[model samples]
Target: MIQLWTPEITTLLTRFFKANHLPYGQDFPGHIPTGRFSNGKLNPDFVASFLGIKQTVPTSLDPNLSNDAFNGLVFASAGSGYDELTTILTGAIPVPKQLGQFKSYIAKLSRIFGNNEAQNIIEKSLAIISAGTNDFGFNYYLLPMRIQQFDINGFQDFLLKALHDFVKELYKRGCRKIVIAGLPPMGCVPILVRKDSSRPSIEHVWRTRMLMPVLQWKARFTETEEGCCGSGLLEASFLCNPETPVCETPSDFMFWDKLSSKRAAYKAMSHLLVNQILPKLTLE
Candidate 1:
């Protein structure tokens, strides 16, 4: 399956938590460090490794790198969302723009491998989309405009419709296999918990509607109150530098940062995706 890391990666590295100094290397064979907002490998890295694909999914935004569709490309950027306004506000690449880049990549693949081969690859490829978290965390709740325009349920509907359109566009581009990730329980996230625990639990109606599955997962974690890295209150990305002390035992903690899951948590999630989620997707 071909992979893409659009605004998700950018947001994770640049804006979300800021892990600028982290080196990009295959420190874990199949896991390449690209300044992800996590203690170690992100969910995508684990998923790709589990699927026996190449570890590093290169960002398509890089100007120097050759467009190699065989290895897969990451179109996701941090702070990006399903909507254009979200992209504009956050300065992250929009989902539609990422799709546009995908189209270009496909064309490049066609040139290299011929149309039939490129089409075959595209049809067989699995596209994993992990977005919408920023839409809520960065835009709807954080910004005044979206909240003013629509109430909780209404905004949820709007975002869902946008997601529908994004999937439709991917289908149109000959992508048959697609997996759209749902939002995690925002209440349990370290940043939200530290900021205002009551808000994520009570005010976030969107979380209440879609958090059952995540809540079930929550029962597995013991360190729900804080992150594993540093103080866990505000430390994240670059803020979690060398000077900052880390937990002696990370396995005891569920999160690695203000908004990211630890390696152990990702491992559990990867297991779920492989055992439970993949089987169903493969069946389809």
Candidate 2:
């Protein structure tokens, strides 16, 4: 989520983190690094392929890249959240600004592909957003100011309002198909609460429906207690460096760094596409 001076990635950057983080794209073909948390393909890439739009999702900000925006593009920044302060802490692109970028993208497309075609693209395109976690992880939990300003419920409401506004903005820009991923069980995440483990924040009734992917993952991987990178507890971004010892069998681990695991992403997508989202969605 660090403000990048350039969208270009070098081989040296891939090996080291400044070449990009050591394992960000370590699982990709030929180990080519990308500016993402996952070691290989992300959830959007899987969604793109399933929808028959494309094979891989590309970042919209890459200066040297060429791709049809109609298929899909990523405006997501790591560590970014709906909360403005969360982005300020990590120098990430704020959700509001990401929406602004989407608007600008439509304008640019209008110039290149004509107004009707551009509008058609936006109306039909699926907009996927994953937020809320950083608001709690980067802002609320890390700083005392959040504690003073908002109670847990108040902060949750604040984030919900921010999310609501963001979706309305997306609707204004012609996005009829949108999927917003909610926060994970905050009480159990490695970065959030490091206690032995208890029931997570989600209520017992909805737990089965909401956490089916998590249940699926318990059997899918050998290691779920920690990440595949280094200590698997606190390391992320630059802290997860080349010197850090990565697990030999990353596929066996549920997490790659502090936040995500590539294999887990694949696992979740399978459940989502087959049982959760695909049948309900009309991508055509």
Candidate 3:
């Protein structure tokens, strides 16, 4: 979370400037905006639905949330990444602070369910961790803040180490069923593409080569190049605010904005990964 007298993220939540929660959810099934970066549900929400735990996985920071977190909840920050600097620059929650929030969530659980049951709940729950894209896109590729210290390869290594450490911390805290989503095609994103970044990182090698049935694209979507948002070249976040014109049919597009995929794309990925992850998380 952003450091202050008290932690706050004024841009999306916490005081008033909610940039992402207006007409942004125009394509959502419920037609309700919930501050997510996309037009509708995220992959984690679809994952929860696939697992039959809940139709929607609530965020941990929901203002009206109660003590019962048994079905699980999201603890993600939209613009955050593996690097603390990346998070700091965007006023998003950092990795360590996210863990701290999890610790607090556990303590609350302990008070309600008792220590043993709380620990048991954590162990039985499934955790989905998604990050790293912003580390390369925001820090290295966009700003060159970390480029002064590390090349793209070195930055990738540093992020991988940070991710390992985060996962280890989660394991220590009793998370047994954990799934990590790797980087998306960031170089092909409208924002990065407009930035003139065409060269893909080494991760692209595996992303293009690996023959994983789970992640294999079915090619259901036709619009792979431009986002549905205005101009489909540079609009993202605040730039993709209300009053901006969007395409009539977003489901045909792979991306909703400059950075994120459309809800349809996430739903597709959710279906694929759920089959792969469900067996592992459910079996013993």
Q: Considering every candidate listed, which one attains the maximal TM-score? A: 3
TM-score of 1: 0.82
Model 2: worst 10 consecutive residues (lDDT sum): 1-10
For each candidate, the alpha-carbon lDDT, in order, equals: 0.68, 0.65, 0.68
- What lDDT would candidate 1 get against the real structure? 0.68
Candidate 2 lDDT score relative to the true structure? 0.65
Q: Which one wins by lDDT: 2 or 3?
A: 3
Best by lDDT: 1
Instruction: Point out the worst 10-residue segment of candidate 3 by lDDT.
Output: 1-10
Q: Write model 2 residue lDDT over 1-284, tens digit each, in one string.
A: 00111112223222322326566678765686666566766666666666666766666666665656546677766666788888666666677887776787889889989999988888877777777887887799887887799999999999999989888988887888777676766544444334434545454335334555655754366565566776745676677767877988876766677655554655465447535765687765
Model 3 residue runs over 4 Å out of place are: 1-19, 197-219
lDDT by residue for model 1 over 1-284, one digit each (tens)?
Answer: 66654323552334543454432112334444455556566566677778777654557766656544366667767667876777655677778888898999889889989999988888988888888887888788888899999999999999999989888988988898788887766665678867775554455555444533433564365565677666655776566666677777665777776666676577677667777888887522
Off by over 4 Å in 1: 5-8, 11-17, 22-33, 62-69, 198-221
State the displacement of the C-alpha of residue 243, model 1, in Å, after optimal TM-score superposition: 2.2
